[model samples]
Target: MKKISILALMMVFGVVANADTLENVKKQGFMKCGVSTGLTGFAEMGADKKWTGLDVDTCRAVAAAVFGDINKVKIVPLTAKERFTALQSGEIDMLARNTTWTQSRDTSLGVNFAGVNYYDGQGFLVSKKSGIKGAKELDGASVCITAGTTTEMNLADYFKTNNMKYKPISYDTADQVQKGFEAGRCDLITSDASQLYSLRTKMKDPSAYFVLPEIISKEPLGPVVRQGDDVWFNIVKWSLNALVTAEEFGVTQKNVDSLAKSSKNPEIRRLLGVEGKMGENLKLDAKWAYNIIKQIGNYGESFERNVGKGSLLKIGRGVNALWSKGGILYSPPFR
Candidate 1:
């Protein structure tokens, strides 16, 4: 009886120890990443059947860190309603779908937010013809919102706090909300300011819609991972951190190769895996971060290429800039 009990205990410990997600990813030969259905400049499929955007780059960075090849990821597009459920159910390895980090979501859901990739805020988008300059003007106006998202509660709170009332026309996806707004189903649409800009560009006349200046609630959007896998969580978290750190050190894709071999800066050396066990600590190859910088790019490069001045969004760095540049973006030391 004692031998049987000891054998059973050993079996349990074996199962627990073998639950490393990184090992599973390697065995499968590819990483599964969840993205939005089709949010322009965040995650969208182009005419060439390729996914390109800020969120897509996040996925590629993780892939490069693990496989040394960015293309070893399969993009799984998910709606806001389906995203968390998919992660919880193990349908994807990680979620880089521009999801917000909130208290209730962080604690209640069986998932963890890696870190804030985009510091955003909720706002309203109205047509120029409405002659409305602010969100407070629409007391009784019908508002279009995406269902099963934080926007629903934000809209309710904003109206109630101001002693106002409005009709809510909720939809399943951002595209549906955009279609409803364009079809005159609602007087205005409310979403993340960046999303509003993306949606406006899809309109017949992008200049006709104007986003309100009032940013209602704080929405620090980032990637997510399952709850039990601390190893995988650390890998994803630091992969994002590497991007910001690389940019802070001026290590772009164009110069990462030379820097890896010749740069003498302590932080840069640790980051590029030239003088430390940073990669080994994360159970990755020594050239993990070097691969990410060489293949995908640093954070600023991804932002500029996908949604900043280099893209149609033309969004200023604003609060997304580095901490040294008067923004909140700061990475922990590689040491």
Candidate 2:
């Protein structure tokens, strides 16, 4: 008997490598998504205890792409301390918990961020009773902040760089930070600007507090998946790209079907799976992107409904807007 080379044997035996995150997700029948423990407008349980927000929508979009159904997902709420651990341990397939894409996090952690869903910056939320007018006025003030987060480091750097002093009242979770701040254990609470707005609404009197005008540090928040899995990375990356691209081309959910069938634009056609083999490259159905748009809508739509003017947070698009509109959001072509 003649022995064949490994390549020839594979061709003859019809053996294909069987390892990828997509296969695992398919086999499990649901995408395990990590999210914030409870941060409004990003990922929070509503009155009905059902998860809903911008981050949650990111997970749903991935589910729509993989399973052609947005409902096929399991929400794993993790604190700042637990999010990366859960993703690294395979306890969650991906994380969409408004995590910042920093140099250290991207390089040191065994994870890769997909894209910036929202451009944010650190800001302080000061109670009206404190009469704090700006972040600069918080010298020697006690601040409530979550532990094991970039918040602590940024706070220290900001105060140190400004030649100011502060006393930190730290907790392990964002919820505890909010509780501590509200209970007057701290003079102010600091976090991302958008997050501060969301946390403010949780107050008994939402109007009693306001985020300072100063945005101290840049925080480009987005989704993340474990490193070393290009298949999974592509799926998550393109899923986000599809959303932004759909928004750019005006391929909204209400008109996606018509656009997919009758659009004269080649780019829109490719995005909607009317042309191109993008889904094939990702090992998903030809309509993977179409499912994401049809089910979850585009990035703009999700932002508007979850954290933008339409939501309780009422945050402005600002830097989160598309590149054409002067913001930095740019997505790769579908084809």
Candidate 3:
């Protein structure tokens, strides 16, 4: 019985250790994605049993690039504590959760962040009754934070650097932390500003909990994949770039086909596969990016539909805007 258990574990590890995510995804005819259990605007399911969110679109865009079909994906809902393990174990091809890309995670976790999809920052959500007007007011407050995350370190660093002291109440899941906050287990909850808005919408009275205006730490959140597969990594990276690049080139789902035929801009023409074999460079179809934009729209479109003014979150683009504007969403040229 002991040997059987060991043998099973070894087999699982062997598969994970040897499998090529790109080939596996191609063979399976669909991409496997890990996502938040249920974070509004980032990753969530609706009444129609269909998944929709900004991160979900990331998965769809990748699928469209691979199969020319955006719907060919399987979303695996995972908790904050389980997301990394699932990705490392080859249980999922990529994680499109609202996960922050940090130095420790990038260097130590055997995972590589493709690119920043949303540039966020840490903030606090305090109940209105607490009357915590600013970060300075919470000197000894008990902050609710999720476990197995970079938040713990940031929380300690922020308080220490500011010469403030606080207690921490940690949980394994976002839902647990939010529940603890709602039940009055902590004085405040600290996480990415975007998540604070997402959690606000889940509150019994969202109006009662407002995020503090103090931005504490930078949180560049994006998709992640295993580290060893360069092909899979580039595919995921460029799929996201496809969205941002499409937006920059004035190509969108509604107009990409037209632009592919009529656009006079050399970059746009090459990007839309009218002149160069951009997709061939990635070992995919020439229409790879065209399919992504035509199916998933651009990054801006996904943002508006899932979390921006167009969605219930009502969050602003802020630092997520294109680099040509004010924000820093810049993508490399297809060349």
> Considering every candidate listed, which one attains the maximal lDDT?
1
**Model 1 regions lying over 4 Å from their true place:** 1-18
> For candidate 1, what is the lDDT?
0.91
How high is the CA lDDT of each candidate model? 0.91, 0.88, 0.89
Clashing pairs in 2: none
- For model 3, the stretches where C-alpha displacement exceeds 4 angstroms are 1-14, 17-19
Candidate 1: residue 229 lDDT (0-100): 83
CA deviation > 4 Å runs, candidate 2: 1-19
lDDT string for model 2 (1-335, tens) is 98655544543454422236788888899999999989888899888978999999999999999999998999999989888877866789999987899999998676899887888899999988788798788889998988777888999999999999999998877788888987889999989888899888888899998888998889888899877788999899999999999999999989999998899999998888888888898888999999999998999999999998899988888878999998889997766
Model 1 deviation from the true structure expressed as Cα RMSD, one decimal place: 5.3
Tens-digit lDDT string for candidate 1 (45-78): 9999999999999999999999999999999999
Candidates by TM-score, descending order: 1, 3, 2
Better of 2 and 3 by lDDT: 3
Clashes of 1: 0
